[model samples]
Target: MDSLLALLKKKSTGQGSFALENIKCDFFISDFDKPLLYTFAPFGEASADTISWGFEFGKNLDVNVIAISLVSNESWYQDPELYELALNLGKLANFSEILGYGGSMGGFGVSVYSNILKIDRLLLLNPFSTLDPNIIPEETRFRWYQRNLEWDSRFNDGAITCSKGVVVYDPLFKLDALQAKRFKDFKLVKLHGVGHQIPMHLNKLGLLKRLVIDFLNNGSDFAWFYKASRNRRFYPGYFAWMQSQENIHLTQRRKATITKCQHSLKKLISSKPGVDSVTGKDIDFIRDLALDNESKDLMKAKMLMEIALKLRPEGEFLKMKVSSYNKRLDGPDL
Candidate 1:
């Protein structure tokens, strides 16, 4: 540890600022003396949900690792201490490389933190810019979530000078204007297969060491990531896509959420739960409706709701949605 940095850390006492407050999270600090890499996935309203980034490379990066997490969908903004804690961790760790990790909403937090934290490299997994006004257009249930993460210019480099940023997401997100050149300065690697999660036995820590070794030796890893098979990019399997969409929908933004189920019948059942409003068909629609809103796919949510009601009866989640679309649909008034 550098003596100057040590002294500075000593002077900075008390609680560190954190994004979430409701729960005390587990903060894992590793290899503090070397450049430190920090990772987090803040789910906001969908905090409890889980998604894998399929990075068999997590352990291969070789740099110091600091993993901090709040509960699922729990707002870090609720507790400024978590922010302070993060900063304090950064200070105390004296990290040369600050890396943020996340996908979906977790991706959004990593981007937002780049402004406040001095980071060197970032591996964002399907990150979202939750607060960007564009989020509203999705009309997915997740578009309207806790007010804290709404995109504010503050996190934008235009407003706040931030470190280099990079994104590793599904191009399907189709977000450019909201973050034009957001990662132009950084190395952006899009994983087509989703690389949602590496197998459990990928020697996490050793792999991380290898990545750091490559980065420090040459400052590049296109070959390294490829050679080590650390960059295996595979998305959710057929059934997983269907489940993931629902999993992602309910966990994060429901509007932008989608259905991975290629089966038309399966999709229909997921999207429509009721048989007839009063006559009652089936609750199968709940599966799709939940998956839609949870994944932030509002359009799908509306579609599923329409089919569900057409088949059976209206329910809680749909009632709220139908009321909004009432002016257009003459089917049944809320």
Candidate 2:
């Protein structure tokens, strides 16, 4: 964490600053002398060192950044002092443009605070509109925040009226999609294959730096950003998601969508490294898909289990699965 802070401090020309220790947030005004970018760090990023590290990428864009790190998820919504400090910083900057940015919990902060900050624009990626489970029961991701919610009516209301902004998200990610719908005013930039981790996916694709620069330079012009980020089509995660969608269509008996999905899956499986380079959970998911798809084809299910076992050789659950498949193949008497 010290190293991360040192790296950020070394890159930017401005001196490091801190809000009241009670607020538990950090601020670093970039030396770039460009428009200020006010970024709210996501939950768990409670310190300057632990905040979002994407500021380094934006440094070259000649934008000044004020990275606000929160000590708790409830801090932003509950504390009026934090909001006042953020707004005052923008006022002090005397810059014509001030943009709010964050993803997930941070995204929620950007939306809620940006409205209050009255910043020129916003760039929210998969932001949660409300932490209230009653409003969005399907959103099960942020359980920590959900359980500890302070329930501020000011921020919790299902409305984020940004002057101009873009909400980038994956429509396939049901929770994020629903949240995006709540922000009916912002331009929606749907990146279908990537789930809740849009920034991570974009960083992996080497598009995040350019995308941030573009959005910072040209406020809510989503068309240009979308065109530049079309490389998502070639991403392996995207293809893997397509394959999963096809499998779903096949299960649902959606003949037309199934046919297209099949062709796409086949092409992806043949040429792309779908789920192979990803987590073991994804491999387990494929095994479950195989078992669910071909319950009668014990051989196919066993093959998938073998593959999963190879990846997770000591996985007891997988071993059990393999045993179950073997028993199914051997017959009830055996």
Candidate 3:
């Protein structure tokens, strides 16, 4: 329990960066003077969680951390006063280095604020370019952000300053890939199999702390990240991605690729049951895949629908699928 965590555990006194309108910033000053790491909160997360994660990652190193939490998905681009206050605090402390780090909504915050804060480096994971549907119509996920688009439209343009940055994301997630591609200046690190939750996956493999520490000491080094991410091959997300690839191969009629993917999926399923559990939607998808494969196995598809219905008895979609399958089975062969 560090002093920052202790303070957060107790209520704030409206003192220095602790209280901001619709935002909360927590500071963890280490015993030794070191580079400052500023982390922004992910969607719907409290500043405490971001601070705790930063403390855990930089605990061994001589690093001071400031974690910012946003009350909503506003992106903080509209708030110039908050940025000014952050800049003043950093100058007051005379920190040796300032780095910004975040993921998802937090990533958006870091991208927008780091420039104003004059951050030396940035480490972002699966960040969104903009929630404005007008700018990015494909970005339909965060509706809350879309509803409250009060900031300057130019703010949603892209990364401004902090030329040196490491953006990590999976190309499989189409929207995240799009966002990562929009960053003209940042160095992209593609972690293929892992979805948007790159930090969680890295943390699970016991490599997140090391990666962050290395990045803090050194700048954006892709080689280190590549070596650290080798363990991702064994992660559940990798297996899930492999299953998706298998579906693609099946659709393409690529027999060799399908066989390889099937073998890999079976092995993964055997080792990781939780990852292999078939849901109603998964079964429906498999049913469609079976039909697309041009297989005359209508009975098998019906059985699958039955299994899906059993899994989710109240699922109207599953019921409709089962009824459709039954109709096809009972209808005259044509």
Candidate 4:
């Protein structure tokens, strides 16, 4: 962080640069008359050499850029240092407009500070509404950090202050979906099955850069984004994450169930229990693999179908495969 601060100071041509104890802000002046993109760093993204999240993308833009970052992942930008820096930044040479952008934790930062920065428009990807346990006791993903961080009531909910913006998130990610619901007037782009890392998935589809640029330049086109994101069906990472989440949900559901025998949930549960979100192309692929292996390798085919059934708990083809394969496996060796 010290190294990056030194570099920013060397490149800064205006008074829009400040490095406080926890927060650091730097301006990459391009065209003063053009808009300014204020971007915040995501969690665990602090680097000693690099600026922040949107530095590379900002460089290509006609607007000036302000990259803000927390020195560590400790505080969620709820610090006296950031308040002082925002005050200092407000007094700088004005641009034509102000815009903010970030993903995940950085997304939370952008929304929380939008009012203070007077942001005209903003873009957030999988942003948290608040890490305040009292506010969202159901959010159990980041427990350790939530307990440690100061969830100052003053900045508890960004949705209250962030008036207008574009929010992109996966509807399948229940926790993120809950967070996305807190915002009032923002345009919500539901990219299903992409998981919490929507930016990464969009980037994988070669659409992230253009999406940001187009949204920042004009505004979000919901139809176009959805159409473009259909390509994720071919990406294995999408299916992998979907399967992982399904597994988690299945485990949770099993734990929630109680048996009359009072046995452990693990002991009573089916070994090849099904999961809900394992639908679509992944199921087809698994089904095909299981069928192909059934004639060549009975044991392997049964195992493959077991995995398939776990992903698509209600898949009829998988049920047939399970029945057929189990009978074959039970038969005496020839």
Q: What's the lDDT for residue 138 in model 2?
A: 80
Which of 1 and 3 is the better model by lDDT? 3
What lDDT score goes with residue 120 in model 1?
A: 60
Give the C-alpha miss distance for residue 200 in model 3, angstroms: 0.7
Q: lDDT by residue for model 2 over 12-98, one digit each (tens)?
A: 444455545445443455553467777766565565345343454444455676666665555544566665665555344545577
> Candidate 3 on 48-163: residue-level lDDT in tens?
32342343344345567676776544555455545666566544544567788888877887777676666888888888766767667887686775777763554565455544
Q: In model 3, which residue pairs have backbone atoms overlapping below 3 Å?
A: none
Q: How far is candidate 2 from the true structure (C-alpha RMSD, Å)?
A: 13.9
How close is each model in CA RMSD to the real structure? 16.2, 13.9, 14.9, 13.4
Off by over 4 Å in 4: 1-18, 246-334
Q: What global local distance difference test value does model 3 have?
A: 0.61
lDDT of 1 at 267: 45
Off by over 4 Å in 1: 1-20, 27-32, 42-63, 72-78, 134-141, 146-161, 173-181, 193-334
Model 1: how far is 235 from its true place, Å? 7.4
**Candidate 3 residue 290 C-alpha distance from true site, Å:** 38
Question: Looking at model 3, which ten-residue stretch has the lowest summed lDDT?
Answer: 7-16
The TM-score between candidate 4 and the true structure equals 0.68
Best by TM-score: 4
lDDT of 1 by residue, 260-332 (tens): 3234444454443333232243445443654566345433344455556544444665566555544332221
